[model samples]
Target: MDDEVTTPDGLRLAVVQRGDRSGPTVVAVHGYPDDRHVWDGVADVLAGSGHHVVTYDVRGHGRSDSPPGRAGYDLELLAADLRAVCDAVSPDRPVHLLAHDWGGCQAWHAVTGDALAGRVASLTSISGPCLDHVGLFLRRRSPRDLPAVLRQALHSWYTLAFRLPVLPELLWRSGTLPGALVRRERVPRPSTRDGLRGLELYRRNMARGLGRPEPRHTGVPVQVLVPLRDAYVTPALAVSATTFADDVAVRYLPGGHWVVRQRPELVARCVAEHVAAAEGDPGTEAPALRRARARGAALAAEGGRAGPASRWSGALAVVTGAGSGIGRATAQELADRGARVVVVDLDPAGAAETAGAIARRHGRHRAVAEILDVADDAAVAALATRVATEHGVPDLVVNNAGIAVAGPFADTGADEWRRIVDVNLWGVVHGCRHFGELMRSHGEGGHLVNVASAAAYLPSRVLPAYSTTKAAVLMLSECLRAELADDGIGVTALCPGFVNTPITTHARFAGADDAEQETRRRAAAAAYTRRGYSPERVARRLLRAVEKNLPLAPVTAEAHAGLLASRLSPTLTRALARVEPR
Candidate 1:
């Protein structure tokens, strides 16, 4: 049953207490930018099994009191509210606390203190920080303040404008909120229904406690479920949280912070396993739980990008076409993440510029820019041999070198077609033929990433040659992946949309002059070119795919939509494709 409770301070909290009135109890906390619905799935599972599950809208969220002012809006206040709820909800039994995102920080505070720590049976911190690896996070993001800092860097104007009180009010009224919402059932429209209170909570939290580090653990048994694609918290934090507490269980989920909505089953199972172990069920394996416990403590030692476990330290990765494109973007991302990169490009100045920028950003030896034409098989072969000897099988090989040419088949000459095929298609072939063998002979395993395009399957008549070459590259990569799977080497075919890159300047049109053609084609093509994401986005997604051992990476709206539509009906796809707007 749901009820409203007014605290001593006059803040009204919406509380959800369901299941048999007499049963074991659990408390679920939600972090910033969200509400208590984050625990709806886990609560349901627990309730069905006769556990008294408790959830409430954190202050300033979900019809909770948005107490005006930053004075009472920090972690301390959040923790106080939690303790009060504990006293009010389940004073008899030791409560099992489940927290995610920022709520995990409050859990760290609530479950660690003497009184609550002893009464709490177990604590699960999902995708929040215990700040055990600050040095590593600082290094990963050169300038520091990785999470909110990166958001500020990305959304500069929002930071400047959102701080003004009542400013979001005007924008919220402009229909910007509803347009931003794609699915109303799950995702609320802009500002959202039952959302302003949450926004106010976030506003005060950010305004007052932006720089405060999360409080350390209360020494309770903690289980940390880290999402592989979390943008705010680093994996280093999840792995390191165990350093402070002796019993920490680390698990990986295959979703975003919105896993409550995206992969509820996975989240529910993880919660079940953690609860089973805590409850000391004879059916659960204790030794295996200990192994999981050890991972939260020492996996950082195994996967640390900087500390002693940095085997890839100073190792060189050869990246081709390293200019102001995906090549440059990947070079920066790798360098930032700790890897020696050999920037290869036909443009000496361009390569030098990229290397210089990377060095400036990361404050290390980012890359050695070498001018070369990858299409020339001998040049690429020699470069591979040099890179192998220079840096042991080039731990990672990203074949992101390619060119694009677009025109009607009538206007495109054999020369134009062959040039595109030579660079886009054969370049990948050269990379595989040479690097694949070098890697197999070198050691345990390595990753080979090939950059294809969405045009491969979702064919585009406007870009015939480029699409054909990309299609060939996609097929080649899949074949290589199957062939190499047994040899301990992994292959990933990356098919991204029209990323915002310089190549868009050459994109063609049917019959107009260059100026008019660009103007006409710019809108649809501009989807990824103007407000479109950077090559860094694709690079990040590619790295994540490699970590998860994914075979194909389709990285764009058109790519994902086409795949979904085709999977639904291929022949019907052809019919629908004819009607799709250009």
Candidate 2:
């Protein structure tokens, strides 16, 4: 239904409503110089999800009539306009609110003040900050927070220009500015009248709101979406609003200021999750939403704490073979860096135990476990799907699951060859193919680590089958590294020479009977133990490789030597490989 709403100031505002009226009402407010049509992509998604979606042009923009003077565009009147929209759409019940840019500024004022405090159920703000909050943020500046303030000041250069008298209107009406906005900012072609009139928003509110800040507080559950790559609004400015709101959650998405247009489905899903949680439907809510509510409740319960930020604070990672040894150590290492971990293994018990340990060490919900056989393509695809649903796309993925088959190639049975290839070679393939797709679709840069071995480059006559599988993994990683580079996804092949892990204990010895196999396994395990390397040490190198986006990372001393010798002194290395180890 398309209708008109008269604000308190007697301004005729255009309102467009869609979806079932009986469903949860969601009112979306557009930013400066942007009409309600900017939300067309997002509104369709929310409507399809069974929410009653509403989008209205702010006064002085779109089909809405502009008020007479600059004072009419103040936060007070803008807040009133928002209140009127809410009253007309869902007068009986509170409506969920979503806003971007200047609309977010006014919505914040409305929710924090008495304008529509109790009338708004939940709030989701994207690429916008409360003007009063920004003032307070700039005022209480510590040495550490100064850099963020300065960075934000740089991103807001246009705001300062917008405040100028004649030049602002001249640029908006000249027809050159709109073309420049499209070419430079990638913004959709804006209406000339909308741009000319919307300038009053900044002129009327910028100095007044920030010049004298207020103690704005709210009980509403607020979700702040920060666009990481926004040109006009820095993430720091958007997330700083969390300091003012008691019950607030902050989420980071990979996009520019016009993220809704680029990733509408993601934005819609996030809004739906927030609305569902507000309605007490926790079944479909994301883990992040649940955690956010719990955190906000805790902050309100027991005053907030000031803690330094960590690299892994908001990051998510998935580690295969995390049940034991190198995989377990890697998962723990990533968690220590502040990342939430998804611990996966072929063994259910091992995966659960590892996940439990991580959860206990960090927070109970920081780590999750999943039982998966990487060799099963369908199973791995399902795991990828589940992880994306439960948690957002993983920032780091470690394909570390592998097995060992030792002895002469001729003596190795066909079944043993197949088993080793399936677990080691095909498993890496499955993880890369499935998880890689998730990372690409996310549009955010991520890293993939494939655990190869020094044996990949080191020729071994006795360990032919094992070496072959490792070598294949190395090549696959190299190929993926080149292919996924443009997508901002990095691929690294980790080659650790010989670490003290349980692989030796489970390794099968070909040409030997069962009893002899047991004897050989023990001997091999002893030799690896004598090498005195730790899985933890190898794990550190793996993290470093991801941090630097290294294509080939050789972990141990022997690994480095093996890689160099294989390239420089191939004849000598091959001669040494021909001699069987005792």
- The candidate that wins on lDDT is 2
Model 1 lDDT per residue over 506-531, tens place: 55444457777678557645765665
In order, what lDDT does every prediction score? 0.68, 0.86
Q: What is the TM-score (0 to 1) of candidate 2?
A: 0.81
Tens digits of per-residue lDDT, candidate 2, 33-119, equal 899998999999999889999999999999898898888898989999999999999999999999998888989989999899679
> Clash pairs of candidate 2?
312-338
**Hey, what RMSD does candidate 2 come out at?**
4.7
TM-score of each: 0.49, 0.81
- The reply for model 2, stretches above 4 Å from the true place, is 138-143, 281-284, 291-317, 333-342, 347-349, 352-371, 382-396, 404-420, 436-448, 453-498, 506-533, 537-582
